[model samples]
Target: MKYVVAWRERPTGSAAEYEAAQKRIREVLALWKMPASLTIHQFVARVGESGYAALETVEPADLQYLIAAFAPFSITVVPMMEVLDVAAGEPRGIEWRNGLPCTQP
Candidate 1:
């Protein structure tokens, strides 16, 4: 199973707050003994937006831990199972069914 984790700065959140949260998250990861299942990680920042986005592909079992790790910011977790190549008109890693791609459980 794979998960997509996204997080953005809270509307009322300040840079100091975000930095503090990141410090805690780093500490947690340092002391945490878990499998390295993350396959992809991306960070995005818009030119004018106050918030940023983080996208990741991780194992199902690690979803809960990631959510807890990013608790300081607004985040969303989505389970994804297939990667579709629209230009090639085919699925890259998993199959599609009923005109919709399957989601990870």
Candidate 2:
């Protein structure tokens, strides 16, 4: 299973506090045993100071383990399935028209 894990940082906290939180999360993820293969990528910050990670893992149960470990902090995990047509390394056909968000007409 693939998951997108998002974490909202504490707005009024110091760097040490934030680092502690991040460290805890990392430890939890390392210890988590899941069925799915795992691939994690941190998201680029947008409107807020929050951060997120996209993970591909085999064990769906790891999601729960992550949530439990991050208790008291806000965490959201969503499972994802790859669209074969859009899988990485595959060619995107001309069916994608211009005027799309990242494309030029």
Candidate 3:
């Protein structure tokens, strides 16, 4: 499965605090190694102190380690599905929902 991992640094009061947070995050990235279950496709940092990555992994649980490693920053893990997959499944999904025995007026 593919995933989009995003992160934003938590609010800091002063410049020194921001620097400390950055240093810690960098240290973690520098020391911690990627696990075998994950494949990083792309990584980029935006103008703000936020960044996101496009990653592919077989086991969803592998991402827990990543979130833990970046505990200093607010992080999110979102599963990605191809546009074609959503389009193909739309009809079946609608059919299944319509077939439900109960409906709301």
The top-ranked prediction according to TM-score is: 3
Number of the predicted model whose lDDT against the real structure is largest:
3
Q: Provide the lowest-lDDT 10-residue window in model 3.
A: 96-105
Write down the lDDT of every candidate, Cα atoms only: 0.58, 0.65, 0.91
TM-score of 3: 0.86
Residue 80 lDDT, candidate 2, scale 0-100: 65
The sequence of per-residue lDDT tens digits that candidate 1 reaches over residues 14-80 is: 7887677668867876886644765555556555443333344335656677667656657776665
lDDT digits (tens) for residues 1-105 of candidate 3: 999999988899999998998899888889998899999999999997789999999988789988988899899999999999989989998999899998667
**Which residue runs of candidate 3 sit more than 4 Å off their true CA positions?**
100-105
Residue 32 lDDT in candidate 3: 97
Tens-digit per-residue lDDT, 33-77, candidate 2: 644455675555457456577787776676677677667467778
TM-score for candidate 1, residues paired by index: 0.45
Q: List the residue pairs that clash in candidate 3.
A: none
The better-scoring model by lDDT among 2 and 3 is 3
Show model 1 residue runs off by greater than 4 Å.
11-35, 47-58, 83-105
